[model samples]
Target: MSETKQSGSPELQWVRILDLDELPEGRVQTVTAGTTSLAITHYQGKYTALDNRCPHQGGPLGEGSIENGWLRCPWHGWDFCPHTGKPPGGYDDGVPTFPVETREDGIYVGLEAKPPRIRTVSDVMVETMTQWGVTHVFGMVGHSNLGFADAMREAERAGKLTFIGIRHEGAAAFAASAYAKLTGRPAACFAIAGPGATNLLTGLWDAKVDRAPILALTGQVDTQVLGPGAFQEVDLATAFNGVAEWSQTVLPSSRHAELMSLALKNAMIKRDVAHLILPNEVQEMPAEGKPATTPEGRVTPMEITPPAASVEAMLKLLRTSKRPVIVVGHGARFHMAPIVQLAEQLNAPVVTTFKAKGQISDHHPLGCGVLGRSGTPIASWFMNESDLLLVFGASFSNHTGITPKKPIIQVDYDAMALGKFHKVAVPVWGEIGITANLIRNELGAIDTVDQRPEVRARWAIWREEKLRREKDDRGRGINSASVFAAMNRVIPENAVIAVDVGNNTYSFGRYFECTRQSVLMSGYLGSIGFGYPAAIGAHCAAPDRPTICVSGDGGFGQYLGELTTAVKYGMNITHVLLNNNELGKISKEQRADELEVWQTSLHNPSFARYAENCGALGVEVTEKARLDECLERALAHEGPALVEVRADALLV
Candidate 1:
C-alpha cells in the first residue's frame, strides 16, 4: 500500500478531523481542514482522506455510499476506490488525497496554509463601490456568487463596507431600498444566479416605482455556458429590463471598475435601480493592476435651479393667493428644512403624501399631516379650503389626492414629473431645496391664511376620537390606537420607523404622530413584508439613531426569519408586532367589496417566544394596560427585541 509522505512537510499544518471510532467501518464522512473539504473514509481497517469533489461534475464524494468496495459519486454514479482515492483501472483521473494520521486522542489530517488573496475583478469593482460612497451591502452568499462574496468579505474586513447576510434575497433588496429611501444614498443588494436573483424583483420594483436609488448585484453562470441553459442560468439582463435603469454583465475584457461606477451614477442620477450581473469566472479574473474609479469628477452637482419664466409664473400665483397650502411628497423628504421655512414664511399649512408622513414633524405649527386615504382630517380640511396649492416634489398620484380643482403651482426637479397627471397653473422644474429657497428669496412678502389654530383644533378632534376608539375595544384584542398611543410615548423622538402594509400601515398613518422620527414604507408598491427588513436597512443607514419596525401579524410572518439576522448582527431594533392572527387588510377589503372574507386568516405561533428563540428580547402584550410597559421594555433593550401586541383587527 502506498502512503502519504511519511516525513514532515512543515508547510502543511495538522488539523484534527475526528475522534477514535467516530466514523463506522465502511462509511464515508465529510470534514473540513483549513477551508478544504475532504471525504474521510474508513474502509478495511484503514482511513483515507480525499478531496470531497467528484472529478466529473464536482459532486460531493462524501455524500456517496460505498458499494462493492468502491465509493460511487452521488450525482453521476462514477466509481472510485474508497481506500486508494483511485478510479477504475481504465480511468486515469483520480481524486487528490491528503495525509491522514490516527492517534490515541483523535484522527487528524494535514492541509496547506491558506494563501494570501490575489486582487481580482470583484476586488477592484468593490473598491470603486466604496469610493463612490456605497457603505452597506445586504446579501446572501451562495455557490455561484462565491468569488464576488469573497471580495466583499475582504472589504468588510478592511472596514470599507458592511455586508449583512439576510435570510432571503427579497429581504436584502427591501433592506437596500429602505436604506436608500432613508439616506438618499444608494445601497447594494446582492444575490446569486437564477432563483436568488429573481427573488429581488419585487423589492427592486418597489424601489423603482418610488424613485429610490438602489444597486443590485447578481451572480450569473460562467460566461461559457451563458447562452445555453446551464444550471441556475437566467438571462438577468432581459429579466431586469424595466426595473433596472441600467443593467450590464461583467465581462473578462470589460472595465470592471468603470461598470461599477456607471451603475452607481445611473442610480444616483435617475433615482432608480441599477443592476450588474457578474459571471462566476469573470469575478475571479485577474484585475491586472486596473485602478478603481471614484465619484469626485464623474458626478455633476445636482442643484438645479428653476428657469426664470417658471419662477416668475410661480411667484405670480403665490403673491395673489390668500389661502395657499404647501403639499410635499416622498421626493421632497430630504429638502424639507427649506420647504418648511418657506411654509412658515407664507403662514401656509404644510401637508405630506402618505409616503412622506414624517418629512415634517406633526408638531410643527404649519404641519397639517398626511393627505389622501391614509391621511389626517386636518390635512383634508386645509387642502379643501385652500385657494392655491403649492405642490413640491409630489407626484399627483390618486392616493395623494392633491386637489386638481385648486389652482396648483407644482415644483419638481424632473421635467417629466412636472404636470404629469394634469395641467397645472405652473409646473416649475428645479431641484426641491434650491427651488424652494429661490422662491423664498424672490418673493419679498406673501399673503396667506394663518392655519395654525385650525391645525391645532383638528389635531385635538382626532386625538379625542382616538381616545374614544381606544376605550371601546371589543373583547377580542387590544386596539391598534392604544398600541400606537403607547408608541407615541415610548418610541424615541428621533427614531427611524419602518412600517409595513395592511391595516397596521393605515393605523400608523392615522394614529402615529411624528415628532422627529423618519418613517419608511413600501410606498408605491405597498409591499407587506417590508417592515422588519426595512428596519434592518434603516439601522444600517443610521446606526446612531433608534430603529423601530411596525408590522401586522400577516406582514411580519412574511419575513420573520429575518429576526435571526437582526439578532446575529446585534441590530438595535424594536419590532412592534401587531398580532391579530389574520390578514386583516385583505379581510376588510373583501368585506368592502361585498364579498365573503375567505383565505384571509393566518396561523401564527407565539411571536414573542419566537423572538426569544432567535436570541432577542421578547415581550407579549395582551391587555391594554400592558402596552406601554411592553413597548418601553422592548425599546430599552440593548439589542433586537420584539413586542407582540395582540391587536383587534377592526380597531385599525
Candidate 2:
C-alpha cells in the first residue's frame, strides 16, 4: 500500500494506482481513478499525472511517446509538455494536470472527489424499460454504446436489471428473443452502430416471425454524421424497417421516456420486435429531470372475448362433431390451461406443432405429442382421423401440415392470424384463453366420443417404436432416440428447453416427453445457433427453472463461444449436444431429393472437453449405456454443463 498525499482540499482522494518502478524514466502510462482516466508521466526523475485525453480531438496522450521532451497526441501529433501539460507555444488549450506523489510502496495520484451522479437520456430511457417490466438485457459494449452501457451498469448495480455481456451481438439478440419467447415478456438486446447493429437482424427476425416480443437497442454514429456516410454509420431505421413493429431514433428534442414507453408497449401489444436507435451524442445528453414513463395506465389487460356469434359458430362444430382434435402452436403457450380444459370437456386429443412441443405434456391423457415432420405418429394419426380440427393460436404453417380439408375452427387474438393461410369453417378472433373458456361454458354436454383411450393406445405404439429404435445401433455412435430418452428421464419437469434446428430437434420432438417443461425455438425463421444462447436467456428470465439446450454439432458449432459466456455468468444450463459429425438433417434432405450429400459432414473438436476448458462440467457419452448416467451428471453439475453424445448420423 502506498501512503496517501492530499495535494489540494480535503475532497482530494489519494489512490494508489501503480506500484513503484511501474513506470521507467521518460515514459507515460495510462491509469484510471474512479472512472477518470489519467496519464502518468515520469520525466527528469519526477512523476506527474495529466488528463489522458489530449486537448486536440480527444486523443490519448498516454498512448504516445515522449519525443523531444513533449507528450504527443497519437491521433494528430499535437504535443504538450511531459511534466506540466502545457504547450510549447503557451496555448490555452492544454491538458489538465493532477497531483502525483512517489510513496514508500507505490505511486499515488490524487483525484478530485467524484461529483453526485447526474441522470442522462440513456438513464431515462432505460428506466422506462424497467418500469415496463424489462428485467434482462444482453449485448456487447462498444465505443458508441458506452453511454447507454453505463446506464445499464447503474441499473444492474441497483438490482433493477441484469445485464449479460455476451460473446457476440448475434448471440445477444438470440438470447433476448428466447427470453421473450419463454417469459411472454420483452427483453432488450443492445448493439453498437453498423456491423454490431446488423448482426442482430437474424435473431430479431426469428422473434418477429415467431411473434415473440423483443426490444432492440442499437447505437448509431453522431447525428451530425448520420447522413454523411461517416464511419460505422448506417440508416438503422431503414435497416430495421421490416423486422421492427416500431422503430425510432432517439433525438435530442424527442420525448425520451415516451419513446421508450411506446417502444416497449408496441413490442408487448403486437408481440413483435421494437427498436430504438441511440445516436452517440444524444445518448449522453442531459435528461433535464424528465420522469421515466411506466406501464401503469399504458397497457391494458389482453383477455379479449370472442364475439357471441363466433363463439356460437365454434360451438356448432364442436357439438356436431363426434371426433374433435385440438391442435396448438407456439402462440398458445401462455393460454394452454384453458385450452387443455376445453379439450378435456370435449374429450379431444391435443397435439402441438413442433415449435409448441411442450405446451401440453406428452404424458397428458389427451396429449398426442408434436405434429408434422418433427412429430410422433400418434399426433399424425389422431389429426388424420379427426372429423373436426380445433386449432388455437396456430398459424397452420405448411411444416405443421394442418390440413384445410377438415372442418376447422381457428382461434387467435390477432385478426390477421385467423385463417391466415386458407379458409376455415369458423374463425374466432379473441384471446385464446378467454375464447376457450367461453366455448367450454356454453357447450354443456357434448356427444363427442372419449379420445383418451385412443390417445393412450397411440402413445403406447409410439413408445414401443421409440424403444425399438433405441435398441438399434449400427456401431457408428449413439442414436438420437436413446439420447432424448435419457433426457426425458433426467431433465427437470419444469425446465426450459431451447432446441436448435436439425435432426437433433427432430428427434427431440419425436422422442422427448414433457411433463411441464417450456420449449423455445426459432419457429418461423428456423435459424441455427439458437440453442445455447437461448438457454442463457431462459436461465436469465427464470433463474429458478432449470435450463437445458438441445443442439446438433452443426448448430452448436455456430455459437460455441457462448459456452464460455454461460460459464462466465455461472448460468446453470445442461447442454445435450448430439455430435453426429455431420449436418444430419441436410444430408437426409439431400438424399430425399436424390442429390449428392456434399458438404454435410463436419469435423468437430470434442465438445465435452471444450466445455471443461470453458470452466464447466463436461461429460462425453459414446455408448447408449452411458446416456442416462452422463445426462444425470451433467444435469446435477452446479454451473453450466455439456453432455456431448457421439451419435449415428442416420439413426435420427
The candidate scoring highest on TM-score is: 2
Estimated TM-score for each candidate: 0.96, 0.97
Error of 1 at 461 (Å): 2.6
**Model 2, range 204-238, lDDT digits (tens) per residue?**
99999999999999999999878979989989999
lDDT of all predictions: 0.92, 0.91
lDDT of 1 by residue, 223-339 (tens): 998888999999899999989999999989898999999999999999999999999999998886799999988888999988899989899989999899999999998899999
Best by lDDT: 1
C-alpha RMSD of candidate 2: 2.5
Residue 414's lDDT in candidate 1? 87
TM-score of 2: 0.97
